[model samples]
Target: MTAPSGTTPNPLEALRAKLAAEPAVVDAAAPVVDAATLEDDYIVCHCTNVTAGELRGLIHEAGCSSLEEIQRCTRAGGSCGKCVPLLTEVVSIELGRAGIA
Candidate 1:
């Protein structure tokens, strides 16, 4: 791999590697829940206690169209970063529901 051609590992790359290696984070066979049926108390990020409703609000009301914006607003995937993919899925659903591009 040529040692990544750098003296120090990139933080973002390191995070990506960690997430990729985390098996318990997400299961491919697990069923995905429809965003439309989620209640306000339905937690999307357990590490940060963020709910689907909050994410919906961020998308619909605050106009957060990207995962970066959502993270900055509520720190959903800031902890272990495991909820990132699911959080992203939920964000897309909410955006689609709100008719935002």
Candidate 2:
């Protein structure tokens, strides 16, 4: 099969070929976390019944920058304020993931 004109071959194919020619290397200490197993729908704030997905959406889509703003938007940490820390952590994770902070 002919490659597209003026284009290079697939870099992934090249890597596969190179790996096929090399000895198998095993690293038992490598960290493995199943992303699918990660909880996203758990209630972050029982007072408002806000889920992690909802908080993440607020941070990403609504552009919430702080826990206060998140509280204003989603009423997450507005009650007993026990979930403020978790709310703050969620905001940090979401904003960092979006490269906003």
Candidate 3:
């Protein structure tokens, strides 16, 4: 392609080429996680504004092995509920990576 006469490669295309060359930095838009572990480790916290780190910490501190126990110990699913789905997704992804899910 002529790149629109005077223009360089499309900014997006250039960025994609750069990213493709670097395997260390994952594309934020596409998080990679295992499927089976996600099913077991995912937790939707509707309360306490908790994140994956908080959930993981609670799980570790409380010696809990399940999401339900995590909720009970940390009150993470006890709030506005807007972030619950995100929380669940983060937990699933992280746990999958950790081989715990």
Best by lDDT: 1
Q: Write the number of the candidate with greater lDDT, choosing between 1 and 3.
A: 1
lDDT of 2 by residue, 1-101 (tens): 34589998888887888888896987533323332233778677889999888877887787777767778888887888766666666667777788877
lDDT for 48 (candidate 3): 57
CA lDDT of every candidate: 0.80, 0.72, 0.56
Q: In model 3, which range of ten residues has the least summed lDDT? A: 34-43
TM-score of 2: 0.57
Tens digit of per-residue lDDT, candidate 1, span 3-49: 35657767787777777787466575343776567888899899989
Ranking by TM-score: 1, 2, 3
lDDT of 3 at 87: 53
Best TM-score among the predictions, by candidate number? 1
Ranking by lDDT: 1, 2, 3
TM-score of each: 0.63, 0.57, 0.41
Encode model 3's per-residue lDDT on 1-101: one tens digit a residue: 23787777788887777778876854543335432334433444434545455666655554556655665776764576555445555656555555677
Question: What's the CA RMSD for each of the models?
Answer: 12.1, 15.7, 9.8
